[model samples]
Target: MNAGRDAQAAATERALARAHGLANAFLASLAERAVSRAPSPDEMAAALDEPLPETGSDPAAVVDEWFERAERGITASPGPRFFGFVTGGVTPAALAGDWLASAIDQNAGLWASSPAAAQTELVVLRWLKELFGLPVEWAGALTSGATMANLVGLIAARQWAGRRLGFDAAAEGLAGHSPIVVVASTEIHLSAVKCLGTLGLGRKQVRKASAPGGSVDIAALATLLRDIDGPVIIVGNAAEVNSGHFDDIAALADLRDSHPGGAWLHVDGAFGLFASASPRLAHLTRGIERADSVASDAHKWLNVPYDSGFAFVRDGAILREAFAASGAYVVGSGGWDPFTHVPEMSRRFRGLAAWCALKAFGREGYRALVERCVDHAAAFARWVEATPDVELMNPAPLNIVCFRIVREGCGKAATDELNRLAVRAIQEDGRAFVTGTIWNGQAAIRAAFDNWQTTLDDVAMLQAAVKDVATSLTP
Candidate 1:
C-alpha cells in the first residue's frame, strides 16, 4: 500500500509539471497576440460540457483537454495592447517566481508556520519602501489588490480618528459614535466609497471636494472641512485613473498641518505611487511621505502578477490594533503574523513574485522602464497633435494618452460615433485592440503605455491603424 501511494504521488507530480509547461507556453504566445479577443458562445459552452469523472483519470490527459478547450476563451490582458484598465503586464522574472511560489505551496500567514515566506515578505516590503522613498520605519502588509488595501488603510484611519475623539470604535464598534465624515475629491475612485460603506459608514457620509484637472482643489477641501462636525478622514488620490493626473500632495500636507485634531489623511496611490520611481514624475507625487497611510498595487505598475497590493502605515501599532484577531485554535507568540496587519488569513506567497521582480530588475532598471513608457506616451501625444484629424483630449502626464478623431465638418455626436466605430474596426479588422473612454463629458480613445514590450514603433503602428480605421469609416 505504501509503494502504491508513492507511485501515485510521483504520477501526480509529473502531470502537474506537464500542465505547468503547457500553461507557460500558452501565456508566452498570448503575450505576442492581440490583447482582446472573446471566444464564441458555442465554444465556451462546449468547453463547459465535459462531465466529471467518477473514477480516477490520467491527470495529464485531463489537463491537456482543459487547456486545449480554454485557450481560445482566454483574454490576453497580459498582452501589450490591453489598455482598457490600469493593468500591468507581468514581468518575466515575476512570472517565473509565481510558478515557483505555486510549486512551494507555502502559506505566509504567520512567522511560525513559514519563516522563509515571512522573511521574504519582510525583505520585499523593505526594498519597496526604499524604492518608493517611504519612511524606513513605516510598516506595510501585502493584500489581494487595491480594494482590500484601501479598505485596510481606511480602517486604520477610522480607528485613529475615533481614538482621538475618545471612542474605542475598533473595540466597541460604531454603535453610539458620532457619524464620521470621509472626504475625497470628486474624482475619487469608487472603491473608496464602497470601502466606507462596507465599514458601516454610509455613502452619504463621504463629502466630495471639488477638483479641477482631476485633482482635489485644496482650498475647496479646506472650506468643506471647516463646516464639518465630528472626526473626519481625508482621502487623497496619488493618481487619477482617467487622466493620470496627480493631486498636489505638498499642498495637501500643508493643509494637514493646519488641522491637527480634525482629520486623518490617507493617500490612495494604487497606480500613481509607483511614479515615485521615475525622477521625471517623482515631483508630481511630492509630499507623499507626509501621508499617515498609503495604499498601492504592485499588479498595476510593478509588473507583478495580479492580486498583489500593499497598504503602508506610518503607525504600525494602529495597523495591528485595527486588524489583529485572537483565537484559541491558533498558536500565538510574541512574533509577527501577517494577519495582524491585513484582512486576510491563510494567504498565499504572493509577495514572492514581487520580491523576485524587484530584485531581478533592481531600482534603476524599473526607473528606466517607467521613464520609457512616459516618453512613449509623450511621443504619441505629439503625433496626435501633429495630425489635424486627431485632437488631443487631455495632457499626457504619465503613460496614458487620451485623444479623439476629429474632422473639419463633423459634429460632436458624429465625431464621437466615428471614434467608436474606428475602435471596433481596428479591433476586428486589424487585430490590434484599443479602447475608448469618456473624458470630461467627451468621447475619446485612450491608450496607456504599461507593457515593457511597447515601444515607439508600436506607437507608430497604432497611430497608423487609427488613421486607417478612421479613413475607412469616412462616408
Candidate 2:
C-alpha cells in the first residue's frame, strides 16, 4: 500500500509540473489568442466520452490529454478585449492564490475544518468593508458570485420579515405567512430577481418605479412605501447592469428610512461596489454603509479569479440565524464559522484568492485599477460618440457603454436586426466582443470594460473592429 501511495505521489508531482508549464504557455499568448472559439467537434467529444478503463492512465498523460483537448475549445473570455458580461480577467496574484487554495483543498465551512481559510476570510471581509466604506462591524460571507450573495442578503431579509410577523422563518418557511413586499427600480438586476423567486417571493410582484430619465423616481417610490404596511425589501442597485448607471444610493437609503413598512435595503453592488475603493469614484457609492445588506462580486471588478463574491449583513446574528445548521459531527472552532451564515456548508476555500488580491494590490493598487477601467470606458464612449453609424442608447455612467448600430433612414426594427447580426459577426471575427442588451426598448450593444490587463491599444483595436463589423452590417 505504501509503495502504491508513493508511486501516486510521484505521478502527481510530474502532472503538476507539466500543468504549470502548459498554463504558462497558454497565458503567454492570451493577448493574441482568439477571444472566442467555435464549439467542440463530435470527434473530440467522442474521444473524451469513452468508457472508463480498468487501468487508469498516469497523471502526466492525463494532464497532457486534458490541455490538448481543451486548448482549442476554450474561449478567451479573460482576454483584454472581451467586453462581454462585465467579466474581469484573473490577476497574477489572485491566480497564484487560487492555485494554492486548490492545492490545499481546504473546506472553508468551519474553522475546525480550516482555521486559516476562516481567518483569511474574516480579515478579507474587514479589508473589503474598509475599502468600500461599508460599516466594519457587519457580518460578511464569501459566496460563489453576486447571485448567491444577493440570495444571502434576500434570505436574511425574508427571515427578518418572517420574524417580525411572529414566526420562525429559518425553522418554518413563509408558507402560511404574509408575503413581504419588495420595492426596487425597474432596472433591478436579474440576479436579485432570481433570488427573490428562489426565496418564495413573487418575481412579478416586485413594485418598480422608474424616473423619466431611467432612474428610480423618488416620488413614485415614496408613494409605494406609504402603501405597504408590513416589512418591505428595497433593492438599491449600486449600478444598473445594462448601462452601468448608479441609482441614487444615498437617496434610496434615506427613502428607506421613511418606509412605513420598515424596509430592509439590500444593495446589489456586484461590480459597482468597487467604485467605493477609488478616491475619485467613491462618491458613486455614497450611503452604502447604511444598507441592511450588500452584495459584491470580486471576480467582476476586483480582477480576482472566478467564483468570488461577498455578502455583508448589518445584523451578524440575524445572518447566522437565517442560514443556521447544526450537527454533532460538523464541529466548529470558537472562531468564525463560515457555514453558519451562507447557504452552503461544504464550500471550498474561496477567500484565499480575494485575500491575495487585497494583499498584493493594496489600497493604492486597487484605486488605480478601478480608476483605470472607468477611464477606459470613458475613452471607448468617446470613440463611440465620434462614430456616425452608432447611437448611444444609454449613457456610460461608469464602465458600461450601451449603444446600437444606426443606419441612415433605417427605423428601430432595422437597427435592431443589424445589431443582432453584428453580435454574432463580431464573435466570429474574434478580435473583440460586445454583448447584446435591450436598452429603453431598443436592441443595443454594450461595451463593458473590467479586465485589469486591458490597455488603450486593445480598446483602440476594439473600436476599429466595431466600426468595421457594424458598418459592414449596416448600409
Which candidate wins on TM-score?
A: 2
Give the poorly placed runs of model 2, Cα more than 4 Å off.
40-55, 211-214
Model 2 / residue 317 / CA error / Å: 1.2
Deviation in Å, model 1, residue 220 alpha carbon: 1.4
Backbone clashes per model, in order? 0, 0
Q: Once all C-alphas are superposed, what RMSD does model 1 give against the true structure?
A: 2.3
Expressed as tens digits, the lDDT of each residue in 248-315 for candidate 1 is 98888777767745667889999889889988889989999999889998887888998899989989
The 10-residue segment of model 1 with minimum total lDDT is 30-39
List ranges where model 1 is wrong by over 4 Å: 40-46, 49-56
| Clashing pairs in model 2, backbone N/Cα/C closer than 3 A | none
Give the alpha carbon lDDT tens digit for every residue of 135-201 in model 2: 8889999999999999999999888888877887889977887877899988889999999999888
TM-score for model 2?
A: 0.96
lDDT of 1 at 69: 75
What TM-score should be assigned to candidate 1?
0.93
Error of 2 at 168 (Å): 1.7
